[model samples]
Target: MELLLLEGVTRTIELPDAPPLTILSGVDLAVDAGDRISIVGRSGSGKSTLLNLLGLLDSPSSGRLVFDGQDVASLSSGQRDRLRGRDVGFIFQQFNLLEGRTALENVMTPLLYASGRQFWRRREIASAMLDRVGLSHRLTAMPHKLSGGEQQRVAIARSLVREPRVILADEPTGALDVETGGTVMQLLDEVARSSGAALVTITHDLAIAELASRHFRLDHGVLTPVSVHAAEGLIAVSGPAAGPATDAGEAS
Candidate 1:
């Protein structure tokens, strides 16, 4: 199923006297359930802007964004909030956990806004999620006490606790060492697959990007398909060259 779709999506920031700065220009993408997509770009390449758009944290200046077949631009602010909380999950590079809260409490935070039985059973759900991420023993551990990899695992648990349809991971392993990052990525991919959630990861690491089934590169607000020839260690741009009408990739 097509969980998310973007067509001619453009984002611009206007300053008082200066001309408008185009952050993302005519970006088109289609993400289906269980799809793994990695987007690579350097700093200031609008990678975070795209992630914000995908996670419903921000809207495009011009164009359409569809989530679960509904036009997001048409949704009321309240409706958009509900949709984002219920259907979309985000894992940030900073491991945005509540500093004073325990790992379990941080994981249970999302369920506080849930309805009915879910809200009441938040602890149980959070516990199971943490366990799934191999952090069962760290339920009472504070964010400061956990290592970087463990903190990221806690963030991952929190992201998947709602069983969201899509997972938006922005530089999820950027703060960890290479070996630890690899392990964290493996756990992330495994959990996403088992839960049947589409994974969209944004990062500058090509090795990490290669883990996804499809890859794209964003430069100066332009998005393009990237074909990685593993054997030759070559990365090639495949279609659309530059624009919002560019194709992302085939769905697995």
Candidate 2:
């Protein structure tokens, strides 16, 4: 069951008196249920742009984006918003929680957009999700009161509260210490697997990237499959071996 697919997707921004800046060019990817994919790239390599496309936050200038076998471009703005809200989850590096909200309140925020019983039972659902992430005791804690790791856990709880089909994590552990980051990542993987959601993580750390079963490197808007030599702690371009890279779009 492919959850999302991108083929020859390209994004460009026009500038006055200068050539258009191509942020992403001919990018292709397919995400299936419960699949874990990690994309690594240097700063300013268009990783964020790609994430936006995958999350339906922005549209590509050219090419196709399919979600659950339906072309994204064919969806109206409201339809797109509904689909994104219902099927997609996002975890960011900054733990974007509201300033005055408690952990439980923050987690329940998304449910406000949901319908019927879900919205009515949002508190219970959010509480359980927080428990799953070991933040049950921090339910009433404000973002300022929780530690960095605790705040990230709250973010994770919020992301999973809706039981989305796909999870988009951007630099999820970028703000934590190495040990804490490792712990958070483990918790994230466990929760996503238990929920049966496909996970797509974008990061600059090779070690973090290696956590996924499939790995790709994005360079200059091009994606290539890569193999990780765990023992040597090195990564090498592995060519088109398996996974989404087999159908990766070429740069235009």
Candidate 3:
């Protein structure tokens, strides 16, 4: 089933010193449950703008976004907020954790706002989620106390705590080393796949994007699919340096 849908979407923005810019132009997309989609492009290629629109953090200037059979534009601001709170999970590049809060507290933050349960119950679930992310021991540690990889893991836990139907990750591995980034991306893929949620990863890394089941490249406000099969064949014939997941193979 199609869990999310966007049709004829267009978005425009104005800068103080520049003319109005069109970020997204007539974009159309449909994502089903368990779809691992990667949107790859350089900075200012409208990849993040598309992610924001998909996550309902920003409204489209024109077009329709139908999520789970409901027209998001038709909903009131409050209703849209509630929908975002319950149905969408976001993992930001910066981690976006409160400095003073412990890892467990940060994970529990979304659930607390989402669930009407008391503090103790929220803590229990939050701890479980942290354990799931392999961060149980660091539960009481503050955001600053954890390493970069650990902080990102906590962010993943927080996003998954609410068991959202869709997980939107914006440059999630941009801040980590290659090995750590791969590990984190693997964990994210596992969790989202296991939970039967569609995962949308917005990234500039072709290797990371290759790990996704579906890949699309955005250029000049247009999206084009990259055939992994063809890329894989080319890599096989080109030898070791031209591996399937290499930046060159992925960038096309």
- Best candidate, TM-score-wise? 2
How do the residues 1-252 of candidate 1 rate in per-residue lDDT, one tens digit apiece? 478999999999999999999999999999999999998877888999999999998999999999988999999989999999998999999999999999999999999999988899999999999999999999999999999999999999999999999999999988999999999999999999998999999986667888999998888898888865443444677676633322223211
173-234 in candidate 3: lDDT tens per residue? 99999999999999999988889999998877767877888877676777766533334432
lDDT order of candidates, top first: 1, 2, 3
Looking at candidate 3, the ten consecutive residues that score lowest on lDDT are 230-239
lDDT of each: 0.89, 0.88, 0.84
Off by over 4 Å in 2: 230-233, 240-252
lDDT of 2 by residue, 1-252 (tens): 578999999999999999999989899888999999998877888999999999999999999999999999999999999999999999999999998999999999999999998899999999999999998888999999999999999999888889999999999999999899999999999999998999999987667878999987788888777865444555677755544332122210
Supply candidate 2's per-residue lDDT for 214.
Answer: 94
RMSD to the native, candidate 1?
A: 4.5
Better of 1 and 3 by lDDT: 1
Q: List the residue pairs that clash in candidate 2.
A: none
Off by over 4 Å in 3: 14-19, 117-120, 228-252
lDDT (Cα, 0-100) at 139 in candidate 3: 90
lDDT winner between candidates 2 and 3:
2
Q: TM-score of each candidate?
A: 0.93, 0.93, 0.88
